[model samples]
Target: MENAPLPSKPHYAILDGLRGVAAVLVVIFHLFEAHATSHLDQIINHGYLAVDFFFLLSGFVIGYAYDDRWQKMSIGEFFKRRLVRLQPMVVMGMIVGAAFFYFQASKLFPMIAEVPVWKMLLVMLIGFTLLPLPPSLDIRGWQEMHPLDGPGWSLFFEYVANILYALFVRKFSNTALAVLVFLSACFLIHLTITGPNGDVIGGWSLTPEQLHVGFARVLYPFFAGLLLCRTIKLTRVNNAFLYCSLLILAVFAMPRIGGADRLWLNGLYESFSIIFVFPLIVFLGASGAVKSNFSARVCKFFGDISYPIYITHYPLIYTYTAWVQDNKIPIREAFPVALLVLASSVALAYACLKLYDEPVRRWLQKKLGPAKVYQKA
Candidate 1:
């Protein structure tokens, strides 16, 4: 107790605000999923950037939550805390996803008539393991997994980032500076090098070490966000950072970043994004500053349910879309229906939190105790 790294209580409102933004981003992205599939890919394709924001935001939160505490607890405690937070929803989501797939399968081939029993079950297995998800060929070139949202990929990474952060980031004395330098360097190196997937490699370049570079580039922000936990405690984030996060968020809507164009610019926008958005969020929340200014109540509201909003929105997207297609509503007409799906998802998720998520989280603390993270001996 006396030996804890630092006695600190984070501003929970920041987390709430972050979750609010993440949920909205995911919602906006889901809107694109609807538009793209129903009839809009040709017009716009960068909706998936919501996943990036989620990952970045996740990194920031983890840093805020456990950066200091990482040194105080045993590795077992860290994992138990994570399991308590993650496993219930994860397992439940998997089961629900499988059931939805089966339900649709029943109608399609109608399980009684033609479900490849093994294959149907296998798809769920793959999904739960975080393997490849089925793509909607009927949609654009982009693939869709029926009965589930596409952004689950980031959740997997969030788990990974948290573990890695606990291991590396939590061990540092000067963590903020170290992570900032390390993460920023890795990001730069990634853009310089090309990937087997074909990033760019020319005048200003590094090595084509895809796995290393990509891992570093993707993770550094989370690490940076962890570092941000420390930085935000001292200095107010620059106003430019906020404007920048919003700007890059706009860029996040572009597909070229995922395409051949990424060769020259893949990591650029993310770097810019973290530089601007992360700090802006930290600054705004920490200093009580606002740009165009939404009401504090609204901001606080979104912040409150951001986690449930993050966890529960996807299933609604799938169930709603499936209903749309089966019922034969046109995309233009279906936007309202889809919006209903989005709102309902948020509401249902929020209700579940009141009824379940919050109580469960608290129970986890009582049973598992306060979440902890530290280096493994």
Candidate 2:
């Protein structure tokens, strides 16, 4: 009886383009990350903030899509829809990471070459379930919860946010939601300001410390974005796409706020950016329209490939980083290959979307029968 007649709202097309832009920046960030010794000198310095932006976007989109539909949708049905939309790429990402593991042999992770094939396969199998593995089982020395694919760690927390929403957060009234978000923001501010690194940078590993950082990273922006959705009004803007896109880049491109002596300055910058700036970008993106066919197509293409690219591209980064380290080549010298890796990552994401993810989701939707689909328009 639930999910019988709920009509899905149209997606914010500019926001989709913005997501693609952020994802691409992340790839660039990682590429430069291969050459840097520390976060301060990382070329695309603030790119890691993309994850926080993603969490904010997720909250906003989820609130837009699901808040009013709860009367017609059950928790089980909500989980099913999310799984259908997200799980396919997750599976494919693990597979791709596994297939490319051997190719990533380098000094950064020298043990990668010696990791037995069976152990790699085992790690891949565990990865497919979106579960975290302990340090003893970390095939890659990086200590990522999902050793096969480093980015899977964020996906893992994403699942947590969804579960929390389905069971608890969705029940809060607007006032209550705002209060929760404010409290979470306070906690996040504390974590970022007092931390040794002066950034919200952990959460990949299985350590207790990283787990704390992960939660700190996810809690506020997600709920705040949701609250923003429920409260703010959208107003029309000219060149909204360009402006929002540039603003996002500026946010991530921001330099470390202070030198090493005043680490909290950087943390303040990060906290303010996440708390105030990202939501404004989303609001602007949602408020505007794609006025031309070219922009529309670009946004559509990017939106279509963004998730696949994000979930699948890091293995290529691992390989590229390894290659760079193995050869003692500066990223400057390796620039051409980095370009190749970028192109290949995009092409591969497109291929997997056409060949696997779309087909599989379609099949799942068909077999699962009629249900609500909150697709981006």
**Which is the leading candidate under TM-score?**
2
Could you estimate the TM-score for every candidate? 0.68, 0.97
Alpha-carbon runs more than 4 Å astray in model 2: 2-5
lDDT on C-alpha atoms for all candidate structures: 0.52, 0.88
Worst 10 residues of 2 by lDDT: 368-377
Model 2 gets an lDDT of: 0.88
Error of 2 at 66 (Å): 0.5
Q: Candidate 2, TM-score vs. the true structure? A: 0.97
Query: Which candidate number has the best lDDT?
Result: 2
Backbone clash pairs for candidate 1 read 16-303, 70-373, 106-110, 135-144, 136-144, 192-206, 199-263, 200-263, 241-276, 245-277
